[model samples]
Target chain A: MVFRELSLPVRLLFYLFLIVAAVSILYPLTWMSYTSLKTNEEVMLSPFGLPTRVSFENIAEAWQTGNFTRLYANSLLIAIVSVVGIITISTTAAYGLARYHFNGNRALFLYFLVGMAVPTQALMVPSFKLMAILDSWAAALHLPVPLLNSPLAVILTYMSWSSLAIIFIRAYFMSIPPELEDAARVDGARELQILRHVMVPLAMPAIATMTIFYFVFFWNDFLWPLIYLHKHTLRTIPLGIMHFEGKYVSLWSLQVAALSLAAWPPIFIYVLFHRRIQRGLTEGALKF
Target chain B: MANTSQAGAAIPRMRPSRFRLPPGEAWRENLYGYLFISPWILGFVMFLAGPLLVSLGLMFTEYAGFKKITYVGLANFEELIKFDIRFIGSLRVSAVFAFWTVSLAIIISLAMALLLNQRFKGHTFFRGLFYLPAAVSGVAMTFVWAAMFEKDYGMFNQILRIFDFDRVAWLTSIEWALPSYIIMRLYGVGHYMVIMLAGLQSIPDDLHEAAKVDGANALALFRHVTLPLLSPTIFFLMIVGMIGSLQVFTEGFMLTQGGPARSTLFYVLYLYIVAFTERRFGYASVLAWLLFLIIMGLTLLQFWLARRWVHYESEEA
Candidate 1:
């Protein structure tokens, strides 16, 4: 028999392997989630055992002690604002680059694609210097505050370096039939009117997919925020959780609870939009 | 009624327009095109290009601070080659990590994708479950894994006890620490699985059937037909995976802290320390350039190898 007609024993083994793999992937995460629902005493007593009593108080205390509400607000603000900027900038640029054939169009598209290879860390030292320059520029212009230690600082960096988003969005725009734009133009719609009315609506799915990607990316980001924002109040969720973990080393239950709380938002989104996110991820990467 | 009707009337604007967009393709198309991408161009020039050039310059110099940047022609690179033991060791660690992680991730992902491609019960659920690790926050995931890899109370050790194996110090033992990271990386195979699945599904099913008709067994079919078609996808994953795994920071940073004996000190992590902790931006820039060259070399090498291995269907036709 051909290997295509697998015997029962082999197929059973395949199922077993898949089960083992799935369990290996999920058990630890579920264990951590379960650990969060238990008391500190319970966790100390039995690390592997299920909670004797479900405790809501652990999560509550974690929220209060970690200042997660404040951190959440900060993270939500940063993620939303940055994603907004990313969507706007990425969509416009993607639309323009994908549709309009200006001179050096291919070169400009190549420019963004090639930028993807330059590791973000390569720009660190210089980015620090550039931020300093911007800070002084802000100061000299008599701005309310220096630009370095603010959400805007991170937003500007994210917006400028959203190459992946641009690639995906541009692909989406390219996939769109230019016939729609032509039809709109024939009806007295200007270029702005065409983009705003037609292309934007057509490319919403890719745009939304990119929004989720960027939002989660910014939400989970540590390095930039770590280097830039020093103020305790300005700390994003990851920073706050890091600090919380450091300070409350023995509070494993509370830390786990905090982590679960922090983990939920992104996981929730990923679970909901697994298909779209996965598809978009592959489309961009597979373009090469 | 007349007064009300008169009140409803509003005046029209006198000005034709405040701003005219230069009245041509310069305004409409080319201008907007440049306008749209102006941010990226500016960012490329200021952030990417400037830093890249500055880093190149600083490779031969010592940039202590802005004003303290002294010209030290090739001293940084020479010192690194001659003296920096940690630098050499970190490179070794990064290479090993990248070599194992990328290959293993790709291989396992392909296996899982093949399994997932089968028509079976609850495969979708299993697929999503596998991808769960990638969805979780890096810091939080590390912490959970940190907890799981605990010597005394960790999940893996607990499983070892159940199987009558000795509870191994997964993260503490010098021998097991790197392996522990590899294990941690395995859980996220779901990501590459998704990509590979897409590629697998894109291959027409009739090709497999046709190969079978020609007396090609399943293994032979996969070898001659499926493998060649999948090569492009695998190559893509390897390039991305190599670049990413080389710069792995969040994992090693949180879990091992490049632990037991600088065993896990990644190249980027080392660069981070030199730049931030030690404030050796000049030396850091040298490391960055070295990193760039290494990645570029490997990527070019892969492209060269792809000429031998990767078979695009388009090229075949």
Candidate 2:
């Protein structure tokens, strides 16, 4: 692994390229942050200029008028519930595939893989119809709760898309040496006990990474939420941003402000989990 | 835990106690597997498979979503191919858009990955910063970019004005609308850069050292060694990128509404309009099938080409 040191010219070129790439990547976000604090008049008069008065008025207004409090709550509930559901079902299924020599296991695994390749566009129309049928069925059964346009609908849809998570977890589980599980079983541990006490804890890092990835995917999802949720109160962040833009067409400052608010949470989470996310993708699963 | 353990021992020891299931127990294990995956299976049969079949059937009919579907075999395809001028134009627009977007995204992201792979101060912070756009929703980013590209009182135009250039009509002008959307899409390089960085890191340092010892310069090393080794990852990213770009909708929907003169009328947006807005479900189905075919063909082509260029070290062994 010995290497020759780079010439001064090459080193300089490398740094120069890094600086340009860094600036280009960060410029739009920094500009958005700065523009969010400016007044409308200032925004129009000097769009790129430093704000004459830095104020929290736009942020306050966006929070209040954009209905983001409700949107945030809805998004959080959906993401959390879906993540829990995905982790539970996928972990069990992945463990079954990894540890058990059951009939049709290979066929079922291939089935799930095919599910990954099928585009959602092919399913959107039918899924909407199914939801309609379910809504009617709920009415006919005199169900106490409304099902359509609820966070529950979004959660169910999110669960349907958990095949990728299942595959990743299954791959991760396969990489774990069977000796650990054998050690547990030798102590007279049952299957569920071995899974709970041994395998789950050993796979915690991969699980944590999957949880974050699922959360980000669910939180940033727009198309499903837009299709299923028709009620104004049930709008998620992306749909809420669309509504805010339609209502406040002329005010770029407020739009930028609201947009920043909507985008910040997931970006912040990515910053905190960047290394884990990278490690999970490259070194954890899909390596072989 | 002790009480549960005692209760567990009190129960008769189940047959086939080992992890391996016996032939008789196989049915029960499979039942449990199906039960575990029941939600996804139910979802697939009811939601995904049903719609796909219905859409395929609908393509041969004239169903405006509200009315009873009347059979009109191949008419929708006929109209799209022969009569509709905008259909072909929109296809061209989408093809061009997908081509440039994927190519530019690959180049920029690879460059970024190369840069990020180098040891630098605040490397972690920069890596996170680069991934910011992907973590954020497309709709929110589109709104921000729309604001930035506003022809009047927009930051971009303002900058151009400062440089003594004409104020460009970013979204409204037919000539500039697609380019505006393309520029807006440049932020998406972050997603692919992370993937590419992962691939770059996986390349062993010994390979580079060997190249250096052979007096191979950076350019030569990259061309002969790095590029060949990186081809498989690049191939994966390109396929994903192409499939994704072909279905570009949110930006066109939110930012340009398929445009000043259908300049930004993307394929998926057109299909969406046909299905939802016009109630032309049959026509939309045909369009959807066409897209599927195109994607499948392209993917197969990529796989075939991969055999020629992709260097898998293990394969030689």
DockQ, all candidates in order: 0.34, 0.38
For each candidate in turn, the TM-score is 0.90, 0.88
The residue-by-residue lDDT of candidate 1 on A1-288, one tens digit each, is: 333478889988988988887776788778878889998788888877899889988899999999998999989988888889778877877877876545566687865665666777776776776788888898999987666788777777766676787877877777666657656765777666777899899988988888888888888888778767889999898888888888888878888998888888888988898887887777765654
Q: After superposing candidate 1, which stretches have Cα over 4 Å from the reference?
A: A1-13, B1-28, B296-317
When candidate 2 is compared with the true two-chain complex, its DockQ is 0.38
Q: Model 2, A1-288: lDDT tens per residue? A: 111266778777866766787787677777788889998888888777779788888888999999889999998999999999878777877777765545667777766555555567655555666677687798999985555787887787777776777777777787677767666656778677877899889888878889999998888778789778999999999889999999987777898899889888877887788888777765532242
Docking class of 2: acceptable
Q: Could you give the C-alpha RMSD of every candidate to the true structure, in order shown?
A: 7.8, 5.0
Q: Note the residue pairs that clash in candidate 1.
A: none
Question: What 10-residue stretch in candidate 1 chain B is worst by lDDT?
Answer: B7-16
- Give candidate 2 misplaced runs (Cα > 4 Å): A1-4, A7-13, A39-45, A52-54, A186-188, A283-288, B1-32, B296-317
Q: Supply candidate 1's per-residue lDDT for A200.
A: 90
- What fraction of the true Cα-Cα contacts (under 8 Å, chains A to B) does candidate 2 also have? 0.35
The candidate scoring highest on lDDT is 1
